[model samples]
Target: MSYSVESVAYWYLSKEEMSPKKLQKILYYAYSWFLTLQNESSDELENKLFEENFEAWVHGPVINSVYDQYRHYGYKEIDKFEGDLPKFDSEALDVMEQVWEVYGGYSGNELENITHQESPWLNARKGYQPLDRCRNEIEDKDIFECYIQRVN
Candidate 1:
């Protein structure tokens, strides 16, 4: 059955299936990807941006973000997921579907737009031209592929 972000967070924090070290790495990588996307804004920087944002987009957001986004959609509390961070699995994938819709297919532009309106992290990069430039790079490659991989 499909799982929600709250369930995944509970699993990660409460269960003993995955290693703490592994979970930490995943979290770190995922956060790093968000930072990279936040920083990059040019298409010319695709390779560099990918290198910097790789883990964040590939694993971090694909999994963690999905859970976070989904849990929120289901009207679940953020504290619950934040309380735990390792129990993610296929159920998190269900949440990811919801995230994609919320994100408008994970378009960097959409992320930027929403980030401007809500997310503090993206707010820092506000009016940063390079951030806009890199939108296409992420859309053409990372966003589409990541969504397909996660759902499949």
Candidate 2:
């Protein structure tokens, strides 16, 4: 089913209750990947790479990473692995609202910083750094996993 961006974000950021360290580590890897791309590629190239690599990573190792970690921590039936998500068109707006509440309405720069911190690969793309752009697609995948746990 189709899920709104907000529902997806809420699921990822607010729904699941990951340990601070685990969450930080995950974000770190994502950010590092984004940064690596940013430092090495042009804007258009970086965007393409981020999009391609993110899709691969999300469906491949990244999903496994979350699953392994959650399973190790005794969390079963994680949504990322299960491919379950909310069905809503306004998901992005909801996610933005939640982000505003949690992050206190970050400026574009602040959002960029956060995106870089969370997924450096996507951040590497100069004009494509907004968390709401293609970057959100990858993050939302992760958030969906988190949301599943949080809602349950």
Candidate 3:
């Protein structure tokens, strides 16, 4: 069963207070890796950790809901999520852990830079130039193949 993106967002925010930007990128990576690792689509309802689709915003892939919830913090670190945490299936837990271990160290700026260089975001924002405000939805297939290439 898929949890809300807010639940997973709080899960990551519970781990560390990140700027809305970083949390967005981490969640994007988590979603992408889960797709590649499980060999499933984010559209596969039973397999999704959350139902949210990411938009290729100027910074990176931003989940509109997550961004709206924390956008008030601007570039500042979002305050600790003072509420419920998430329970994950073992596979989802492993994917999130692996994402954290690898991408967690980077700042929001760095993660944004990294995602900007990636195909999922680039493909979605193809017609828009850098610094362009594009809200095109990122395709999960592109993201799945993008991360799979890194693994192979």
Candidate 4:
């Protein structure tokens, strides 16, 4: 089943308290790994998981809508999520769980630092300043390549 970025973000928030910055980066990683995990086994699955691409912000890749929703909290950990919780099939849940298990342990700033060094974020932020608001979308192909390469 497909899930919205907000839905994924809410799921993560439900499990842990984190700043919006961390939520955005975690969603990006989850989306990336969801694609890499499936590989080419199902194009439909990729489309379902990635309804939209993330923009390269100074902090990291972000779903602008999701960011806007929780921006009021500033750099504080989000205390509550008001959106509907997303329901997924067992397979999708497994991927989400694995994503949290691996990346969830890091602090938001750490995730941001890691993304800054990664190709997908760096490539999209090419020519952008540290505080620039970049609309450049981090390509899924690049995300897939970067994560898949690390796994191999």
Q: Which candidate is the best by TM-score?
A: 3
lDDT of 4: 0.81
TM-score of 1: 0.24
lDDT at position 126, candidate 4:
86
Write down the TM-score for model 3.
0.91
Q: Rank the candidates by lDDT, best first.
A: 3, 4, 2, 1
- State the lDDT at 56 in candidate 2: 22
* Residue 119 alpha-carbon offset, candidate 4, angstroms: 0.3
lDDT of 1: 0.32
Cα-lDDT of candidate 2? 0.35
lDDT by residue (1-152, candidate 3, tens digit) is 66778777887888878888889989998888887888654354246667789999998999887878888999899877878776788888898889999999999999999998899999999989888889899987788778877776
lDDT-best of 1 and 3: 3
Q: How would you encode candidate 2's per-residue C-alpha lDDT over 29-86 as one tens digit per residue? A: 3333333333333222222112222322221123233334455544222333233555
**lDDT by residue (tens digit), candidate 1, 38-78:** 33332332421123221122212233444344443342222
Cα error, residue 44 of model 1, in Å, equals: 39
Scored against the true structure, residue 4 in model 2 reaches a CA lDDT of 30
| Model 4, span 6-79: residue lDDT tens | 67777888886889888888888888888888766333335446586799888888888888898999988898
Worst window of 10 by summed lDDT in candidate 3:
40-49
lDDT of 2 at 93: 40
